[model samples]
Target: MAQEVFWRRKTLREMNREEWESLCDGCALCCLHKVEDEDTQEVFYTTVVCHLLDMNSCQCTEYERRCQLVPSCIRLEPEDVETFDWLPITCSYRLIHEGKDLPEWHPLLTGERSSVQQANASVLSVYEVRDNEISEDQLIDFILDED
Candidate 1:
Protein backbone atom coordinates (compact mmCIF):
# COMPACT_ATOMS: atom_id res chain seq x y z
CA MET A 1 0.00 0.00 0.00
CA ALA A 2 1.17 3.52 -0.83
CA GLN A 3 1.41 6.07 1.96
CA GLU A 4 -0.78 9.10 1.40
CA VAL A 5 0.63 12.45 2.33
CA PHE A 6 -2.19 14.85 3.13
CA TRP A 7 -1.48 18.49 2.26
CA ARG A 8 -3.00 21.04 4.53
CA ARG A 9 -5.21 23.59 2.84
CA LYS A 10 -3.92 27.10 3.52
CA THR A 11 -6.12 30.09 3.84
CA LEU A 12 -4.60 33.39 2.78
CA ARG A 13 -3.80 34.25 6.41
CA GLU A 14 -2.22 30.86 7.05
CA MET A 15 0.23 31.09 4.14
CA ASN A 16 3.81 31.99 4.89
CA ARG A 17 5.56 34.75 2.93
CA GLU A 18 7.19 32.30 0.53
CA GLU A 19 3.95 30.42 -0.10
CA TRP A 20 2.03 33.65 -0.59
CA GLU A 21 4.57 35.05 -3.02
CA SER A 22 4.79 31.79 -4.95
CA LEU A 23 1.05 31.92 -5.61
CA CYS A 24 1.55 34.53 -8.33
CA ASP A 25 1.48 32.73 -11.72
CA GLY A 26 3.22 35.56 -13.62
CA CYS A 27 0.22 36.04 -15.94
CA ALA A 28 0.31 39.86 -15.51
CA LEU A 29 -3.48 40.10 -15.88
CA CYS A 30 -3.76 42.11 -12.66
CA CYS A 31 -1.16 44.53 -13.92
CA LEU A 32 -3.70 45.82 -16.45
CA HIS A 33 -5.79 48.91 -15.76
CA LYS A 34 -9.30 48.45 -14.40
CA VAL A 35 -12.36 50.64 -14.84
CA GLU A 36 -15.04 50.33 -12.22
CA ASP A 37 -18.59 51.34 -13.00
CA GLU A 38 -19.55 53.88 -10.37
CA ASP A 39 -23.22 52.93 -10.34
CA THR A 40 -22.91 49.13 -10.61
CA GLN A 41 -19.48 48.67 -9.04
CA GLU A 42 -18.53 46.31 -11.87
CA VAL A 43 -14.88 46.34 -12.89
CA PHE A 44 -13.76 46.31 -16.51
CA TYR A 45 -10.17 45.31 -17.24
CA THR A 46 -8.01 47.13 -19.77
CA THR A 47 -4.94 45.99 -21.67
CA VAL A 48 -2.83 48.89 -20.45
CA VAL A 49 0.11 47.73 -18.40
CA CYS A 50 1.12 49.36 -15.16
CA HIS A 51 4.25 51.49 -15.44
CA LEU A 52 6.01 49.40 -12.81
CA LEU A 53 5.44 46.15 -14.73
CA ASP A 54 8.21 44.63 -16.82
CA MET A 55 6.56 43.44 -20.05
CA ASN A 56 9.10 40.78 -20.92
CA SER A 57 9.29 39.13 -17.53
CA CYS A 58 5.65 39.89 -16.63
CA GLN A 59 6.89 40.88 -13.17
CA CYS A 60 6.83 44.17 -11.34
CA THR A 61 9.88 46.32 -11.93
CA GLU A 62 9.45 48.05 -8.57
CA TYR A 63 7.40 45.61 -6.55
CA GLU A 64 8.84 46.35 -3.09
CA ARG A 65 8.55 50.13 -3.51
CA ARG A 66 5.44 50.28 -5.71
CA CYS A 67 3.24 51.83 -3.03
CA GLN A 68 5.77 54.61 -2.45
CA LEU A 69 5.88 55.48 -6.15
CA VAL A 70 2.24 54.93 -7.01
CA PRO A 71 0.23 56.22 -4.12
CA SER A 72 -2.94 54.53 -5.42
CA CYS A 73 -1.33 51.10 -5.59
CA ILE A 74 -3.25 48.57 -3.50
CA ARG A 75 -1.19 46.10 -1.53
CA LEU A 76 -2.35 42.46 -1.47
CA GLU A 77 -2.72 42.01 2.25
CA PRO A 78 -3.77 38.71 3.85
CA GLU A 79 -7.01 40.11 5.26
CA ASP A 80 -8.19 41.38 1.87
CA VAL A 81 -7.52 38.20 -0.11
CA GLU A 82 -11.06 36.88 -0.43
CA THR A 83 -12.46 40.35 -1.14
CA PHE A 84 -10.33 41.00 -4.20
CA ASP A 85 -12.75 39.83 -6.90
CA TRP A 86 -11.12 41.93 -9.57
CA LEU A 87 -8.24 39.50 -9.72
CA PRO A 88 -8.66 37.30 -12.80
CA ILE A 89 -10.30 33.84 -12.77
CA THR A 90 -6.97 32.46 -14.01
CA CYS A 91 -5.01 33.93 -11.15
CA SER A 92 -3.24 31.40 -8.94
CA TYR A 93 -3.94 33.32 -5.74
CA ARG A 94 -7.62 33.51 -6.58
CA LEU A 95 -7.68 29.84 -7.59
CA ILE A 96 -6.00 28.72 -4.40
CA HIS A 97 -8.25 30.90 -2.31
CA GLU A 98 -11.34 29.42 -4.00
CA GLY A 99 -10.09 25.87 -3.45
CA LYS A 100 -9.49 25.34 -7.17
CA ASP A 101 -6.61 23.63 -8.94
CA LEU A 102 -3.77 25.45 -10.67
CA PRO A 103 -3.81 25.20 -14.48
CA GLU A 104 -1.51 22.79 -16.29
CA TRP A 105 0.76 25.54 -17.60
CA HIS A 106 1.31 27.25 -14.27
CA PRO A 107 5.01 27.58 -13.49
CA LEU A 108 4.62 25.80 -10.15
CA LEU A 109 3.12 22.84 -12.02
CA THR A 110 5.30 22.86 -15.16
CA GLY A 111 8.56 24.31 -13.77
CA GLU A 112 8.77 26.49 -16.88
CA ARG A 113 8.42 30.23 -16.67
CA SER A 114 7.42 30.52 -20.35
CA SER A 115 4.49 28.08 -20.09
CA VAL A 116 2.09 30.90 -19.26
CA GLN A 117 2.96 32.72 -22.45
CA GLN A 118 2.87 29.52 -24.48
CA ALA A 119 -0.54 28.60 -23.11
CA ASN A 120 -1.89 32.06 -24.05
CA ALA A 121 -2.67 32.72 -20.41
CA SER A 122 -0.22 35.62 -20.09
CA VAL A 123 -0.39 39.23 -21.24
CA LEU A 124 3.09 38.90 -22.70
CA SER A 125 2.50 40.42 -26.15
CA VAL A 126 -0.96 41.97 -25.95
CA TYR A 127 -0.68 45.16 -23.94
CA GLU A 128 -0.21 48.89 -24.28
CA VAL A 129 0.85 52.10 -22.40
CA ARG A 130 2.62 52.38 -19.10
CA ASP A 131 0.30 53.96 -16.46
CA ASN A 132 2.19 57.27 -16.49
CA GLU A 133 1.38 58.05 -20.14
CA ILE A 134 -2.25 57.01 -20.01
CA SER A 135 -5.29 58.64 -18.46
CA GLU A 136 -8.32 56.86 -16.93
CA ASP A 137 -10.61 57.85 -19.78
CA GLN A 138 -8.34 56.23 -22.39
CA LEU A 139 -8.63 52.82 -20.79
CA ILE A 140 -11.97 52.12 -22.49
CA ASP A 141 -10.27 51.99 -25.86
CA PHE A 142 -7.78 49.43 -24.62
CA ILE A 143 -10.34 47.20 -22.92
CA LEU A 144 -9.92 44.39 -25.41
CA ASP A 145 -8.87 40.70 -25.62
CA GLU A 146 -11.59 38.07 -26.10
CA ASP A 147 -11.22 36.69 -22.62
Candidate 2:
Protein backbone atom coordinates (compact mmCIF):
# COMPACT_ATOMS: atom_id res chain seq x y z
CA MET A 1 0.00 0.00 0.00
CA ALA A 2 1.14 3.57 -0.57
CA GLN A 3 1.92 5.84 2.36
CA GLU A 4 0.02 8.96 3.19
CA VAL A 5 1.82 12.28 2.95
CA PHE A 6 2.99 14.12 6.04
CA TRP A 7 0.40 16.86 5.64
CA ARG A 8 -2.49 14.41 5.53
CA ARG A 9 -1.19 12.28 8.37
CA LYS A 10 0.09 14.85 10.82
CA THR A 11 -1.54 17.78 12.55
CA LEU A 12 0.00 21.16 12.05
CA ARG A 13 1.49 21.04 15.55
CA GLU A 14 2.92 17.58 14.97
CA MET A 15 5.05 18.54 11.97
CA ASN A 16 8.74 19.28 12.30
CA ARG A 17 10.05 22.72 11.30
CA GLU A 18 10.91 21.70 7.75
CA GLU A 19 7.57 19.99 7.23
CA TRP A 20 5.70 22.97 8.58
CA GLU A 21 7.61 25.42 6.42
CA SER A 22 7.05 23.36 3.32
CA LEU A 23 3.30 23.54 3.86
CA CYS A 24 3.22 27.15 2.77
CA ASP A 25 1.87 27.37 -0.82
CA GLY A 26 3.64 30.69 -1.62
CA CYS A 27 0.41 32.41 -2.68
CA ALA A 28 1.63 35.54 -0.87
CA LEU A 29 -1.91 36.75 -0.17
CA CYS A 30 -0.77 36.93 3.42
CA CYS A 31 1.64 39.64 2.36
CA LEU A 32 -1.26 41.95 1.67
CA HIS A 33 -2.22 44.56 4.21
CA LYS A 34 -5.46 44.14 6.18
CA VAL A 35 -7.63 46.39 8.29
CA GLU A 36 -9.91 45.57 11.16
CA ASP A 37 -13.18 47.37 11.76
CA GLU A 38 -12.94 48.88 15.22
CA ASP A 39 -16.62 48.26 15.96
CA THR A 40 -17.38 44.80 14.57
CA GLN A 41 -13.73 43.67 14.51
CA GLU A 42 -14.22 42.29 11.00
CA VAL A 43 -11.00 41.97 9.03
CA PHE A 44 -10.81 43.26 5.47
CA TYR A 45 -7.97 42.59 3.05
CA THR A 46 -6.48 45.51 1.18
CA THR A 47 -4.96 45.45 -2.28
CA VAL A 48 -1.82 47.12 -0.96
CA VAL A 49 0.87 44.56 -0.23
CA CYS A 50 3.97 44.76 1.86
CA HIS A 51 6.79 46.79 0.46
CA LEU A 52 9.19 43.91 1.07
CA LEU A 53 7.20 41.49 -1.06
CA ASP A 54 8.80 40.73 -4.44
CA MET A 55 5.92 41.20 -6.90
CA ASN A 56 7.24 38.66 -9.38
CA SER A 57 8.16 35.98 -6.86
CA CYS A 58 5.36 36.70 -4.33
CA GLN A 59 7.82 36.16 -1.47
CA CYS A 60 9.14 38.42 1.20
CA THR A 61 12.51 39.96 0.40
CA GLU A 62 13.40 40.07 4.12
CA TYR A 63 11.77 36.92 5.40
CA GLU A 64 13.97 36.53 8.45
CA ARG A 65 13.45 40.07 9.65
CA ARG A 66 9.84 40.51 8.56
CA CYS A 67 8.31 40.90 12.02
CA GLN A 68 11.06 43.26 13.10
CA LEU A 69 10.56 45.39 10.01
CA VAL A 70 6.76 45.31 9.91
CA PRO A 71 5.37 45.68 13.40
CA SER A 72 1.92 44.49 12.34
CA CYS A 73 3.10 41.32 10.65
CA ILE A 74 1.47 38.21 12.10
CA ARG A 75 3.87 35.30 12.30
CA LEU A 76 2.03 32.05 11.73
CA GLU A 77 2.60 29.39 14.38
CA PRO A 78 1.07 25.98 14.89
CA GLU A 79 -0.28 27.13 18.24
CA ASP A 80 -2.36 29.74 16.43
CA VAL A 81 -4.01 27.32 14.03
CA GLU A 82 -7.46 27.89 15.53
CA THR A 83 -7.14 31.62 14.85
CA PHE A 84 -6.39 31.18 11.16
CA ASP A 85 -9.90 32.18 10.08
CA TRP A 86 -8.46 35.59 9.39
CA LEU A 87 -6.24 34.07 6.72
CA PRO A 88 -7.24 34.01 3.09
CA ILE A 89 -9.74 31.31 2.06
CA THR A 90 -7.14 29.92 -0.36
CA CYS A 91 -4.32 29.88 2.18
CA SER A 92 -2.76 26.47 2.65
CA TYR A 93 -2.20 26.88 6.35
CA ARG A 94 -5.81 27.87 6.87
CA LEU A 95 -7.01 25.03 4.65
CA ILE A 96 -4.97 22.45 6.52
CA HIS A 97 -6.01 23.84 9.86
CA GLU A 98 -9.63 23.58 8.81
CA GLY A 99 -9.12 19.93 7.79
CA LYS A 100 -9.38 20.73 4.09
CA ASP A 101 -7.18 19.20 1.42
CA LEU A 102 -4.55 21.22 -0.41
CA PRO A 103 -5.80 22.78 -3.62
CA GLU A 104 -4.96 21.19 -6.98
CA TRP A 105 -2.46 23.93 -7.77
CA HIS A 106 -0.49 23.63 -4.54
CA PRO A 107 3.23 23.16 -5.09
CA LEU A 108 3.15 19.90 -3.18
CA LEU A 109 0.44 18.61 -5.49
CA THR A 110 1.57 20.11 -8.82
CA GLY A 111 5.32 19.94 -8.05
CA GLU A 112 5.64 23.43 -9.47
CA ARG A 113 5.97 26.48 -7.28
CA SER A 114 5.00 28.64 -10.22
CA SER A 115 1.61 26.94 -10.50
CA VAL A 116 0.19 29.45 -8.04
CA GLN A 117 1.14 32.45 -10.15
CA GLN A 118 0.34 30.60 -13.32
CA ALA A 119 -3.20 29.96 -12.01
CA ASN A 120 -3.58 33.69 -11.36
CA ALA A 121 -4.64 32.93 -7.79
CA SER A 122 -1.73 34.81 -6.35
CA VAL A 123 -1.61 38.39 -5.12
CA LEU A 124 0.33 39.23 -8.29
CA SER A 125 -2.96 39.47 -10.20
CA VAL A 126 -4.88 41.57 -7.65
CA TYR A 127 -2.58 43.88 -5.72
CA GLU A 128 -2.97 47.54 -6.57
CA VAL A 129 0.12 49.05 -4.94
CA ARG A 130 2.86 48.49 -2.37
CA ASP A 131 2.32 49.68 1.19
CA ASN A 132 5.31 51.99 0.95
CA GLU A 133 3.61 53.87 -1.88
CA ILE A 134 0.58 54.81 0.21
CA SER A 135 -0.22 56.27 3.59
CA GLU A 136 -1.83 54.17 6.32
CA ASP A 137 -5.04 56.19 6.09
CA GLN A 138 -5.37 55.26 2.43
CA LEU A 139 -5.57 51.52 3.05
CA ILE A 140 -9.37 51.63 3.16
CA ASP A 141 -9.44 52.88 -0.39
CA PHE A 142 -7.64 49.72 -1.50
CA ILE A 143 -9.98 47.26 0.17
CA LEU A 144 -10.57 44.16 -1.93
CA ASP A 145 -13.96 43.81 -3.49
CA GLU A 146 -15.08 40.58 -1.96
CA ASP A 147 -18.08 39.06 -3.69
Q: Summing lDDT over every window of 10 consecutive residues in candidate 1, give the lowest-scoring window.
A: 2-11
lDDT of the candidates, in the order given: 0.78, 0.92
> Which prediction has the highest TM-score against the true structure?
2
TM-score of candidate 2 relative to the true fold: 0.96
- Every candidate's CA RMSD: 2.5, 0.9
Q: Estimate each model's TM-score.
A: 0.85, 0.96
Worst 10 residues of 2 by lDDT: 53-62
TM-score of 1: 0.85
For candidate 1, list the clashing residue pairs, or say none.
none
Tens-digit lDDT track for model 1 on 17-40?
A: 887777778898887777788999
The true-structure Cα RMSD of candidate 1 reads 2.5
Expressed as tens digits, the lDDT of each residue in 33-147 for candidate 2 is 9999999999999999999998877899999999999998889999999899999999988888899999898999999999999998899988999998999999999999978
Pick the lDDT winner: 2
